[model samples]
Target: MLCVEFFAILFLAYVILSLSFERFLVSRVKELYKSLIPTTSYINSINQAEDIDILTSNLQKLNSEKNLEIELLKKEQDYRREFIGNLAHELKTPLFTVQGYVLTLQDGVKDKKVVKKYLKQTSKGVDRLIYIIKDLDLITKFESGIASLDRKSFDIVEVVRNVFELLEMRASKDKIVLKFDKEYSKQLMVFADKDRIQQVLTNLIINSLKYGTERGVTEVSIEILKENKILIRIADNGEGIDEQHLPRLFERFYRVDKTRSRNQGGSGLGLAIVKHIIEAHDEKIFVESKVRIGSEFSFSLTLNQD
Candidate 1:
């Protein structure tokens, strides 16, 4: 009988001790949480029962959000670094070429043929430099909201015809023909910035002409997509862009064939400008390409119902 009583007392003592330890641990955890987030409204809402699980879950959530923000900031930093590097490289090439030509002229090697060649090369370099600077300035204006669209009703087909006339000589030089997929009604009108849209058409056609195979064809077509939207597509039958290059094709100074791009003598800002102009009108642009086939550039514009 006495051993049974003693055993019961010991069991009671053990139970009390366990409860005390549990209470102590919970209290310490609450204090730690308060220290970590003393001013948090979440702490104030916590009950005295002090569920550690709740606090832990909230902490984990906050931590995850902070980590995500940090990652985004890192990506943005990397992009800016790459952009600055590309800009410097593009500008440096033309500047150095012009400098070299000037030095050659200064060396007193004044054969008429040599002088004419040097002068012509120098002029081309200057023109490329001017184009790059102007394009950069234009993009900055677009981003800063200083460049605005003067929206008006204009015939898109007429715009395409004008662009063809403007680029006819260059296209002919490459034996690349520009044509429409079908005869469209001349009254098809779009609501957009006419001059900006013209610029976009000119850029895409010029790009097609530059990279197209000899005697290739570039066709422009229009489709009425919806009640208020129309899609304009420019497709080429020359060398198509690789899939990987399609994404960055509209980026500034990005060239699929870097050597060919340089030899082609362009400032490499044309597509980028085209992208900005279309986006300024709140429209989207898209590209489709296949290796050894051809590429197409398309954009949507609001229809002018009036």
Candidate 2:
């Protein structure tokens, strides 16, 4: 009987110890599961943060590209507007002139004098059209960067003299005195395209004549600056340009007085061409004007020391 009781007590103690150990293991497993849940949540949050960052960067880049495209589109639109405006103005002049002459001829006034006058007017219109087309072609070539300059070293004074001689007839007809004051030596040479320089000079001189007062003296002076550049000034005592009109002087087809410009036989491209030619030579042009006081147009080009 005693042996039996002792064995039963030992069995009971082993069963209690095993049950307590099982409960402890269950609690430990629950704690480990709770910790794992928080760790998994933290990992998901980190992934979401990375995704947000990536999306933000992409959005910024896309916005930047969109702005750039908008700017390019705006510039293209502006260019188109300017081109169309110039074209219409250019076409309108010759068309109007031709229409006027044709209508006059159709008026049953077939006198020889009337016919001759109409024919001359028609010819002038055609010539103006041709000039406009030529200038437009030149401007297109210049803007497209395909125009080549016939670069050579030549005496600038000689070129100026040639321009004066070439346009002397027109100046004489207009009674505009064309004079050149040599502030530098007669042997001053500049490296540039001879024809282009002559074109620029002629255009400036003609412009001076067109706007100048009757019997007004137009002066062309060349000065050597300390910066090793040469300044060529074309000054005229014309019905001076308005302060507001000065800024747009170099713009294509821009005219201070439209009717007057037309009457004076300007295509409004002369100054623009001058601007481009000077720029091609890596030079700059400037203008100073006072209303009714006269205007001075000047350009500077680097001297060819070599």
Candidate 3:
């Protein structure tokens, strides 16, 4: 009877312990699952699993996912901080410029020539502020999905020529020769937002002029990638960018040489705008650069079937 009773007691204890183990794991799982903040997209799957093996597996996966998410959030936070700081500095510089000129003029200068020059400078400062504000507005629209492309079949070659003609004087002033790789005997048609594509072309050619050396050549080329793909390339023989800066080249206000870029007189949001425009069109834009050789910017457009 004692042996039988001892066996029964052992069975009872095993059952109780098994029940207790499950409750313990379930409660602890709830605790850890609760600890995860919603900064990243961790799936909310709670497994009140009775099996120890399954429970442990679930916990491990959750922990690993949370750790990765936390790291991503930290990196994003750093970039956000940098972007905010750069934006503030960009706005402040033009504001101070306008203020200084305004105050100088307010002091009642007698020279007509000096007053005229100051007024011109003040106007230029105002123009810069306007450019920044307008570009910011455009980017915000693009980000929020308010901006859209009115894609249509158009002659890409003709557009390129028009842009070249429009910027011919500016290019000439900088001694930058704008030309095509080869003459197009017939119109090369592609489907895209004509106006936005023109804007992209304008911004890229202007960028080449801004960063390129005097007498540099800015060349445009078109290639047929496949039956459906048409590639448009704008290449420049300018001071090429370092590989390190290439990744963030399309980011707003990202300058390799901040002072020189500022002096170059652009909104500093040109590349950012160009990126958004291309991305919105569901196409990718790319850049290839060598430190001293030069840089080439390219994007593909859909070849119009009709």
Top lDDT model: 1
Candidate 2 local lDDT, 1-306, one digit each (tens): 999999999999998887777656545543543454444432233322234454456447857998999999999999899889878978897989998998888886658997998889999888888888999999889989999998888888888888889889989998988888645455777888989988998888888888888888889998889867899999999888888988889988889999888777776899999999999988999999887778899998767787
What C-alpha lDDT do the candidate models reach, one value each?
0.88, 0.83, 0.87
Clashing residue pairs in candidate 3 (N, C-alpha, C atoms within 3 angstroms): none
lDDT per residue as tens, model 1, 202-241: 9999999988999999999999897699999999987898
Full candidate order by TM-score, most accurate first: 3, 1, 2
Clashing pairs in 2: none
Candidate 1 is scored at a TM of: 0.83
Off by over 4 Å in 1: 1-39, 47-49, 266-268
Candidate 3 residue spans exceeding 4 A from truth: 1-50
- For model 3, residues 152-228, the per-residue Cα lDDT tens digits are 99999999999999999999999999999998989888889999999999999999999898989999999999769
Preferred candidate (lDDT higher): 1 or 3: 1
Candidate 1: residue 184 lDDT (0-100): 78
Which window of ten consecutive residues has the lowest lDDT sum in model 2? 41-50
Worst 10 residues of 1 by lDDT: 41-50
Q: What ranges in model 2 sit over 4 Å off?
A: 1-48, 100-110, 182-185
RMSD of 2: 14.0
